[model samples]
Target: MEIVLLEDVKALGKKGQIVKVNDGYARNFILPKKLGVEATSKNLNDLKLQKANAAKVAAEQLAAAKELAEQIEKVSVTLKMKAGEGGKAFGSISSKEIAAAAADQLKLDIDKKKLVLPEPIKTFGNHEVPVKLHKDVIAKLTVKVTEA
Candidate 1:
């Protein structure tokens, strides 16, 4: 029997996939568990429409991410930090601080978790920060740190 998967099944298929399984398995596991439904003609048509809509939304998101990446690359964010006489920061500049600075300067709301910082910055200088906007899109932002 053919069924439309509502959610992903490990080692089987992903969500919205139409797959063939044994009749007993479909009736006992997929249908009862609400993981899948019988792939009737009406259901298949609805699935196709849903898939198309999802694809359109994904494409739009990708385009927006690309535009945001371009804007981020062109702008430089300045952060002021208290530094010692030797030019070392009192503490360290973390990704969270960078994210807040970016938000304040660029007027873009971004999560600190999305900021990819391999390590916290200790010295004051210009550094390139990578922002992961999407799985396929990465934006490089220039951060200039100066003594407060």
Candidate 2:
């Protein structure tokens, strides 16, 4: 008997997969546990429709991410910090501060966790920060640090 998996079954198959199992196993385990349903013509058609819908949604998300990346690349956030003796910075700029600055200055909603900062910025100049907007989209944001 052919079965359409509603959820993953270890050692058998993953969700949305069609697998053949013995009649007794299908009736006793797969059906009773609600892990899968008998794969009829109607069920197969439904699966096809579901796959098409998922593909459409994923494409839309990718397009939106691309658009956001473009917007992010054009933005520059300016932050102020106190200057210490011997040309050293009194305080360092963190990812949280950068994100807040962007939100306040440019009205951009960037996640601090997504900002790739190897360490707190301590220099007083222009810096390019890489922001991971999506799985495939990485945008560079210009940040200008000035002495207060």
Candidate 3:
């Protein structure tokens, strides 16, 4: 029997996929659990429409991410840190601090988790930070750390 999966099944296939299984298994486990439905004409048409809608939504999100990436690339955030002897900072600047500083100075709602920092900022100088706006888009943000 051919079935259209509503959700992913590790043993079978992914969601919105059509797979063939034993008739008894389809009637007993899959149908009773509502994990899949019989692949009729109506169900197949509904799946096509759903896939189209999902593609449209994904494209929209990608476009928005690209636009935000352009805006983020043009802006820079300045941070102040307490300096110790011989041009050294007292503490390191974290992604949380960068997010807060961007919010306060540039009015940008940047997620701290998206900021890819190999290491915390510990020096008092100009640094380039990569902001992962989307899976395909990455923006470089200039961070100028000055001694306070």
Candidate 4:
């Protein structure tokens, strides 16, 4: 039996996909769980429309992310930390701190996980940080760490 998947099903298919499965499985499991529907002519047409709509939404989101990346790349964020006379910080700064600083300074809400810090910063200086805006979009941010 042919069915249209409403959501991703392990070992079967992804959302909006038309797949052929055993009639018993389709009737007993997929339909009952609201994961899929019978692939009738009407349902097939609806699936096509749904896929198109999803693609359009995804494209718009990608464009927005790209624009955000460009804006982020153009700005430099400064962080004030307590440091010693030799320019060594009293405490290390992590990605979470940087993310919070970016949000507080730039008014942009960025996730800490998206801040790519290979190692904690322990000195006062200027550094370049990489922020992942999207899977295909990344921005290099300039951060200036000053002694407070």
Which residue pairs of candidate 2 clash? Answer: none
TM-score of 4: 0.90
Per lDDT, the best of the predicted structures is 3
Per TM-score, the best of the predicted structures is: 3
Cα displacement (angstroms), candidate 2, residue 106, comes to 1.4
**Could you give candidate 3's per-residue lDDT for residues 21-127 as a string of tens digits?**
99999999999999999999999999999999999999998999999989888989999999898877999999999999999999999999999998999998899
Clashes of each: 0, 0, 0, 0
Poorest stretch of ten by lDDT in candidate 2? 83-92
How many steric clashes does model 3 contain? 0
lDDT digits (tens) for residues 1-148 of candidate 2: 9999999999999999999999999999999999999999999999899999998998998898899889988879999989989877898999999999999999989999999999999999999999998888889999999999
Candidate 3 lDDT = 0.94
TM-score of candidate 1 versus the correct structure, residues matched by position: 0.91
Q: Which stretches of candidate 2 lie above 4 Å from their native place? A: none
The deviation in Å at residue 105 for candidate 3 is: 0.9
In candidate 1, what residue range of length 10 has the lowest lDDT sum? 83-92
Candidate number that wins on lDDT, 1 or 2: 2
Candidate 4 residue spans exceeding 4 A from truth:
none
lDDT of each: 0.92, 0.94, 0.94, 0.90
